[model samples]
Target: MLTRKQMELLDFIRTRMGTDGVPPSFDEMKDALDLKSKSGIHRLITALEERGFIRRLAHRARAIEIVKLPEAMESGGFRPRLVAEAAPPPPPPRGALAIEPVHALELPVMGRIAAGVPIEAIAHVSHHVAVPGSMLSGKGQHYALEVKGDSMIEAGINDGDIVVIREQTTAENGDIVVALVEDSEATLKRFRRKGNMIALEAANPAYETRLLPDHAVKVQGRLVGLIRTY
Candidate 1:
């Protein structure tokens, strides 16, 4: 059985998609449900997904597919629609070589990592997300992290964006990386070496760069690519 908020969110999505041919944005959902923050909407969406009423598409902005509806909604003529499908690519010119289709691989979305303040260390996979194979960096293991704050926005990373990271222990100055701090929290920031200390720099000026002893910071992975859903 769905919670009252979950049912309301599901119905809102259904109504918006029926009229707009696409699901509403997170902001829209938040407003419709009178939620205090987008996090509430995220939780409601996840509940619906786990209950088999919806599915979130990977690598697409605001791509949600309604899989099933409650009996009341069904009686009202709601139809399931796959909203993430992209139109076919254009054919190559006669003299040019044909491009191969892009292949997708599923990678574990370990959990949300902070782009502002450091969050609890992510220890286990929360879910899987399909990523384009081309997005994977050279040969090493890669994983995805859902960004949870706006401190990296100036670097093109934003809250709610899923970042694809290549597993690595070392990074050059200015490289965005997931840094485990003091072994208890993890944050996404640019890595810098300053004398014997390591600087975790945020791209947004609103946040000050955090400098800690080199031994206190552990480089978990270097960011290679990013995915965002509108």
Candidate 2:
């Protein structure tokens, strides 16, 4: 098991590596963690290595490698990565995959769903995103949704933007959530609750705020990012 410090360090490494395509150096980790000295960061890495949580190049300068998870686990669970190439290849890439290799996460354009006034456009799935699998809650098992309307224009969400939505059914107040409203419509808006009233506030004033009883609105997912393609 990883200790708190080791786990935190591990998280930093994984996040940076997965997203930035590089592992953080000892100095970067030191500064990120606010350690008084670079040695402080090294001490933590040493501890992690001792715990079988990470590995490093033998006498290789600047080589701090962590043990990556199995391919099955990498695609199935949440495994933070600080370095992008620390592990082996995942299953062969699917030919139809649209994302580039350097991006952190690439989501398939499923189809478009309504965001504002619900249109009937084939919703020509706008584009894909480069995000980490760990960024989403359910890993590769997670699917993508095409945004349909402009109800969330105020939130910077526009028509045809492929939103990275985490699959979830519950969210905290003030979270930009993808809600299945009345079980018939899915909306992307700010979650607000006041006793019995639940309001989905559209960031853009062009669309009116949606309000309903708590029972009438259900959380679907949280907005993670927007994918815009040329």
Candidate 3:
């Protein structure tokens, strides 16, 4: 929930950064709202920042990135909580059932692995895959993959597990990422790219990491949610 002024600030930050990729300074913010002093704006900004909405540099210019656009405000953001107000339940599985955005698409478990062997062949799909998707924001196609190795054990992904992969191109630092190596193959690892060097790092110390020239790496999608059951 956001106060009226906070919502305005949210809009201000998002409109500036989402369109321009740069944030505004305090003075700029003050001018945008036509306030007499920066204190009023500063107080609201501090509150929004504390609530996990924005990030600000301690002592730098242009230090605000719009994390979430203020879609809901105190005045009009109150959504009715009636049983009848709920959205219709998702459709049944397969064949034109109503599906949420980015759902777990069933895929095959393929084959087993031996060290120094090719990634594996989907000789027969031992099982199906289920990838999750967001109904509100991620209203797109979805798919899943099976984990083959323990390279990401530190990241809590283990061998012989179903790894949900939403197809995308851009991701942030520390996102458990799926990537393509040299256009020849694909692998799962934590991805971090800056400038020319690319590092496909493993979370477990037992596995050797792969370092690639920036041109050789292609980022696929970021990890946002997961599902596991015993």
Identify the leading candidate in terms of TM-score: 1
Taking all chains together, each candidate's TM-score versus the true structure is 0.58, 0.47, 0.45
Expressed as tens digits, the lDDT of each residue in 35-143 for candidate 2 is 6788878778887787676788887766767685323223432332333444554666678555444536555443565777533322122334456655566542233
The full ranking of all candidates by TM-score, starting with the best, is 1, 2, 3
Greater lDDT among 1 and 3 belongs to: 1
Give the Cα lDDT of each candidate: 0.83, 0.63, 0.58
The TM-score between candidate 2 and the true structure equals: 0.47
Please give the range of 10 consecutive residues that has the lowest summed lDDT in model 1: 76-85
The positional error of residue 230 in candidate 2, measured at the CA in angstroms, is: 2.8
Best model number under lDDT: 1
* Location of the lowest summed lDDT over 10 successive residues in candidate 3: 109-118
lDDT for model 3 comes to 0.58
RMSD of each: 15.8, 15.8, 16.6
